[model samples]
Target: MNNKPVGRAPNFTNACIVMFGVNITWVLVVIWSLWGLLAAVFLGLGVNHLIERGRVWAAARQAASIRRGKRF
Candidate 1:
């Protein structure tokens, strides 16, 4: 299984549906849409940071785990 995160883009899509389908839910929909955008920006930053240093980080962590004789 792939463990990569897909993040929060779906909330915006849900917001669009709610905005068109039910006027009463528009406020909630807007909140969800904003939340999705915030989550996406953070997710993008995190992934970029990880991609830039992931190999080195992963290798170091793996070595530490092996040295400690930890098993998954």
Candidate 2:
């Protein structure tokens, strides 16, 4: 019995990458299958928040431009 690490029998990097890909795919499938409704709700909330923030930012910029008397 030898304790030296073999140079070839196992390709660690390939195995790791393959396993990671499968894991990610499985996670995506599970999410799509089981949590799509919840995911959509969250997605909607995120988009709403982003739109509201953009609106607020635009309003603020317009107010600033008016105060400055031109586009700054």
Per-model TM-score versus the true fold? 0.29, 0.49
- For residues 1-72, could you state the per-residue lDDT of candidate 1 as single tens digits? 999998865558778866755753454457558787666566556756877798888888888998999952
* Winner by lDDT: 2
C-alpha lDDT score of every prediction, in listed order: 0.69, 0.78
lDDT of 2 by residue, 1-72 (tens): 899887866659988979977975676667667878577566556766998999999999999998999974
| RMSD to the hidden true structure, all candidates | 14.7, 14.7
- Candidate 2, after superposition: displacement of residue 43 in Å? 0.4
Alpha-carbon shift of residue 24 in model 2 (angstroms): 24
Q: Ten-residue segment with the worst summed lDDT in candidate 2?
A: 39-48
